[model samples]
Target: MRAPKSHVRVALATTLLAGAALTGSAAAAGFAHADSSRAGDANIAPVGRADLHPEASPLFSVARRLPKVSADQVLRLAESQVGVRENGYGGGTKFHDWYMNSPRARETVARDGGKVTDYRNAAWCDMFVSWVGDKLGIRPAMGWDAYTVSHASWFKENKRWGTHPVRGAVVFFGWDGGKLLHNIDHVGFVIKDNGDGTIQTVEGNTGNGKVEIRTRPTADVVGYGYPVYTA
Candidate 1:
């Protein structure tokens, strides 16, 4: 016998409601399963904090309020380290320690046939620039070598080498007028163009192993390596 039209409608509606309930329950269970899979993972945040509730977290608020790093900020960071001095001859200064603590420090030391512990007192002008780059998140790609020649060559091969000065560019120096990627002796971060064929720079391991802000004639600069910074 054919059921009443109203009864058929009610039956269909009941089936749809039951199906929806089952689907919702399955979805919730799946979410729970996924959450459990990450239960002991140290990188996973706690349950209440797992979601992206930036407004609810103080850390996120502080991060949001922090200023964006630009070329000017990078120059400032280099300037702030200007007064750092080496402790002795072999290794011990904060600047050297900073470089040694960098993620690639071990590789750099090994490549240079240097002891990791002795890197603190090495001719670290290049390492200082590298550390600054690492802090600014512009390194490795910007060339993180502790050797000036290696760093300059990396820049040249990457097409970042130039003679023109840009603020925050890495300046390579060769005391004997050696070429840019060869015989490079020291490196520093350029602060500004003096407009008189010179540039002001903050350099490490200068004038008795102290970081100093100094003026260098453009003629002494073999080349400038520009970092890929947005600002």
Candidate 2:
């Protein structure tokens, strides 16, 4: 149901990012991928990889550049991708290409037990989240992972987990609707609390296989992950 980015995602981003610090124009944040020949994304610049690994940056990857990371930045970048659709074949988008090419794909496959190419067409809601942060050069604070459960667990382990919706929180969900992280089936970035028991969100791999905005009930949220955004 949730399938994936393909070509023209900008030339620089064709290479594997692998938690590498990213820098370049805002186009690098596009939701699609550069073609195999490095044609780049048609609508956006692909996020280029910097030599510095994620471990090296820890949490201030964007701090070195913007010095003031905000949820709005994340929202804007995510919102810009609203109409992005996955390749109809289900395995050909840039998100898949990016993740597949990454060293993290191996780590994830080893931990999750699968071949790296299995991710070529895997459910990509989490990958979408990872892509957004990676492009923003905030993966250190934003965190990145392919599985929703592991990603949510990371937030808990880091002491960045919380209840209550806040603008920019990473919201984990259980389709059956509850607070059990293990039951979490999906994830998205919070846009705002509607005060109607729902929150507006921007999500990838949703709505006919395209990135789209959604209104979800709080009852479905397991918890929120707070990133270390600058004040």
Worst 10 residues of 2 by lDDT: 4-13
lDDT of 2 by residue, 86-173 (tens): 8864556788888888766765665556577878778878888888887876775676777777777666654456786888888888
User: What is the Cα-based TM-score of model 2?
Assistant: 0.72
Tell me the spans in candidate 1 whose CA falls farther than 4 Å from its real position: 1-68
Lowest summed lDDT over 10 consecutive residues: which window, candidate 1? Answer: 10-19
Residue ranges of candidate 2 with Cα displaced over 4 Å: 1-67
C-alpha lDDT values of all predictions: 0.59, 0.66
Per-residue lDDT of 1-231 in model 1, one digit per residue for the tens?
011121111111111100122223534433112232322233322222223222232222111222334567778888888788777853467766776676555554444454666554467787678777667665532457556666776566444567777787889988878663555678998888899988999998888877899999887888887654533
The C-alpha RMSD in Å for every predicted model, in order, reads: 24.1, 12.6
User: What would the TM-scores of all predictions be?
Assistant: 0.66, 0.72
